[model samples]
Target: MADRDKDSSAESRRILDRIAREADSSGSSLVSRTVKRARDHVSAADVDEKDWVDHLGTRIGRVLGLVICVGLLAWLVMFLVRGA
Candidate 1:
Protein backbone atom coordinates (compact mmCIF):
# COMPACT_ATOMS: atom_id res chain seq x y z
CA MET A 1 0.00 0.00 0.00
CA ALA A 2 1.25 3.52 -0.74
CA ASP A 3 0.27 4.79 2.68
CA ARG A 4 2.19 2.01 4.47
CA ASP A 5 5.28 2.59 2.36
CA LYS A 6 5.27 6.29 3.18
CA ASP A 7 4.94 5.62 6.87
CA SER A 8 7.89 3.20 6.90
CA SER A 9 10.05 5.58 4.89
CA ALA A 10 9.36 8.39 7.27
CA GLU A 11 10.21 6.20 10.29
CA SER A 12 13.50 5.06 8.79
CA ARG A 13 14.52 8.64 8.04
CA ARG A 14 13.75 9.66 11.60
CA ILE A 15 15.87 6.81 12.94
CA LEU A 16 18.76 7.76 10.67
CA ASP A 17 18.55 11.41 11.75
CA ARG A 18 18.64 10.46 15.43
CA ILE A 19 21.69 8.25 14.93
CA ALA A 20 23.45 11.03 13.01
CA ARG A 21 22.84 13.48 15.84
CA GLU A 22 24.18 11.03 18.43
CA ALA A 23 27.34 10.43 16.40
CA ASP A 24 27.83 14.18 16.13
CA SER A 25 27.40 14.97 19.84
CA SER A 26 30.51 15.61 21.96
CA GLY A 27 30.93 13.05 24.74
CA SER A 28 29.80 9.71 23.35
CA SER A 29 30.97 10.83 19.92
CA LEU A 30 34.53 11.18 21.15
CA VAL A 31 34.56 7.58 22.29
CA SER A 32 32.96 6.52 19.03
CA ARG A 33 35.59 8.42 17.03
CA THR A 34 38.44 7.00 19.09
CA VAL A 35 37.20 3.49 18.48
CA LYS A 36 36.85 4.22 14.78
CA ARG A 37 40.37 5.60 14.59
CA ALA A 38 41.83 2.65 16.46
CA ARG A 39 40.09 0.30 14.07
CA ASP A 40 41.26 2.28 11.03
CA HIS A 41 44.77 3.31 12.02
CA VAL A 42 46.19 0.81 14.48
CA SER A 43 47.76 -2.39 13.20
CA ALA A 44 47.18 -5.89 14.53
CA ALA A 45 50.90 -6.66 14.39
CA ASP A 46 51.79 -3.71 16.59
CA VAL A 47 49.24 -4.69 19.18
CA ASP A 48 50.44 -8.25 19.15
CA GLU A 49 54.05 -7.19 19.54
CA LYS A 50 53.31 -4.84 22.43
CA ASP A 51 51.24 -7.49 24.17
CA TRP A 52 53.98 -10.10 23.76
CA VAL A 53 56.63 -7.74 25.07
CA ASP A 54 54.54 -6.78 28.09
CA HIS A 55 53.74 -10.41 28.91
CA LEU A 56 57.38 -11.47 28.73
CA GLY A 57 58.53 -8.48 30.77
CA THR A 58 56.06 -9.26 33.53
CA ARG A 59 57.08 -12.94 33.63
CA ILE A 60 60.78 -12.12 33.75
CA GLY A 61 60.34 -9.64 36.59
CA ARG A 62 58.34 -12.13 38.65
CA VAL A 63 60.96 -14.86 38.17
CA LEU A 64 63.80 -12.52 39.08
CA GLY A 65 62.04 -11.40 42.23
CA LEU A 66 61.38 -14.98 43.34
CA VAL A 67 64.98 -15.98 42.74
CA ILE A 68 66.27 -13.06 44.75
CA CYS A 69 63.90 -13.84 47.63
CA VAL A 70 64.95 -17.48 47.74
CA GLY A 71 68.61 -16.55 47.66
CA LEU A 72 68.15 -14.18 50.58
CA LEU A 73 66.41 -16.88 52.63
CA ALA A 74 69.20 -19.34 51.91
CA TRP A 75 71.83 -16.83 52.97
CA LEU A 76 69.97 -16.10 56.18
CA VAL A 77 69.66 -19.81 57.00
CA MET A 78 73.38 -20.35 56.39
CA PHE A 79 74.29 -17.40 58.57
CA LEU A 80 72.12 -18.64 61.42
CA VAL A 81 73.48 -22.21 61.17
CA ARG A 82 77.09 -21.06 61.16
CA GLY A 83 76.55 -18.84 64.17
CA ALA A 84 74.90 -21.64 66.16
Candidate 2:
Protein backbone atom coordinates (compact mmCIF):
# COMPACT_ATOMS: atom_id res chain seq x y z
CA MET A 1 0.00 0.00 0.00
CA ALA A 2 0.97 3.65 -0.15
CA ASP A 3 2.84 5.32 2.69
CA ARG A 4 -0.17 7.34 3.96
CA ASP A 5 -2.41 4.28 3.85
CA LYS A 6 0.17 2.34 5.87
CA ASP A 7 0.31 5.11 8.44
CA SER A 8 -3.46 5.23 8.73
CA SER A 9 -3.64 1.46 9.13
CA ALA A 10 -1.00 1.58 11.87
CA GLU A 11 -2.92 4.28 13.71
CA SER A 12 -6.16 2.34 13.42
CA ARG A 13 -4.47 -0.77 14.76
CA ARG A 14 -3.12 1.15 17.70
CA ILE A 15 -6.56 2.52 18.52
CA LEU A 16 -8.11 -0.94 18.29
CA ASP A 17 -5.36 -2.32 20.54
CA ARG A 18 -6.03 0.38 23.11
CA ILE A 19 -9.79 -0.40 23.00
CA ALA A 20 -9.11 -4.11 23.50
CA ARG A 21 -6.84 -3.45 26.49
CA GLU A 22 -9.41 -1.15 28.05
CA ALA A 23 -12.10 -3.79 27.61
CA ASP A 24 -9.89 -6.34 29.37
CA SER A 25 -9.02 -4.04 32.26
CA SER A 26 -12.55 -2.77 32.78
CA GLY A 27 -14.20 -4.08 35.97
CA SER A 28 -17.41 -4.78 34.08
CA SER A 29 -16.10 -8.09 32.81
CA LEU A 30 -18.39 -11.10 32.77
CA VAL A 31 -16.77 -12.92 35.71
CA SER A 32 -17.27 -10.16 38.24
CA ARG A 33 -19.57 -10.87 41.16
CA THR A 34 -21.43 -8.58 43.48
CA VAL A 35 -23.71 -8.99 46.44
CA LYS A 36 -27.15 -7.49 46.41
CA ARG A 37 -29.42 -6.62 49.26
CA ALA A 38 -30.30 -9.52 51.63
CA ARG A 39 -27.07 -11.32 50.81
CA ASP A 40 -27.90 -12.21 47.24
CA HIS A 41 -24.87 -12.98 45.14
CA VAL A 42 -25.11 -11.68 41.62
CA SER A 43 -22.63 -12.74 38.97
CA ALA A 44 -22.12 -11.01 35.69
CA ALA A 45 -22.77 -13.27 32.73
CA ASP A 46 -20.48 -13.47 29.74
CA VAL A 47 -21.67 -10.80 27.36
CA ASP A 48 -20.68 -11.37 23.74
CA GLU A 49 -18.12 -8.89 22.47
CA LYS A 50 -20.14 -8.10 19.35
CA ASP A 51 -23.20 -7.49 21.51
CA TRP A 52 -21.33 -4.77 23.34
CA VAL A 53 -20.32 -3.13 20.09
CA ASP A 54 -23.86 -3.35 18.78
CA HIS A 55 -25.18 -1.79 21.97
CA LEU A 56 -22.71 1.05 21.67
CA GLY A 57 -23.76 1.63 18.10
CA THR A 58 -27.40 1.72 19.13
CA ARG A 59 -26.66 4.26 21.85
CA ILE A 60 -24.74 6.46 19.41
CA GLY A 61 -27.59 6.35 16.91
CA ARG A 62 -30.13 7.23 19.58
CA VAL A 63 -28.04 10.17 20.76
CA LEU A 64 -27.63 11.46 17.24
CA GLY A 65 -31.37 11.22 16.59
CA LEU A 66 -32.13 12.99 19.86
CA VAL A 67 -29.75 15.82 19.01
CA ILE A 68 -31.24 16.28 15.60
CA CYS A 69 -34.78 16.28 16.96
CA VAL A 70 -33.87 18.76 19.66
CA GLY A 71 -32.19 21.07 17.16
CA LEU A 72 -35.24 21.03 14.91
CA LEU A 73 -37.56 21.69 17.84
CA ALA A 74 -35.42 24.59 19.00
CA TRP A 75 -35.39 26.11 15.55
CA LEU A 76 -39.13 25.74 15.22
CA VAL A 77 -39.73 27.25 18.65
CA MET A 78 -37.48 30.22 17.90
CA PHE A 79 -39.10 30.78 14.57
CA LEU A 80 -42.58 30.76 16.07
CA VAL A 81 -41.59 32.98 19.00
CA ARG A 82 -40.05 35.57 16.72
CA GLY A 83 -42.90 35.34 14.19
CA ALA A 84 -40.40 34.61 11.43
The 0-to-1 C-alpha lDDT of every candidate, in the order given, reads 0.72, 0.65
**Candidate 2 lDDT by residue in tens digits, 1-84:** 699999999999999998887678556654443333212211212334468776566556666776798999999999999996
Question: What's the TM-score of each model vs. the native?
Answer: 0.40, 0.39
Error of 2 at 33 (Å): 29
lDDT for 41 in candidate 1 is 35
* Candidate 1: RMSD to truth: 18.0
Question: Which stretches of candidate 1 lie above 4 Å from their native place?
Answer: 1-50
lDDT of 1 at 47: 37
Clashes in model 1: which pairs?
A: none
| Clashes per candidate (backbone, < 3 Å) | 0, 0
Give the range of the ten consecutive residues with the poorest summed lDDT in model 2: 37-46
RMSD of each: 18.0, 17.5
Candidate 1 residue-wise lDDT, 1-84, digit = tens: 999999999999999999888777665668777887654433332234567876566556666776798999999999999998
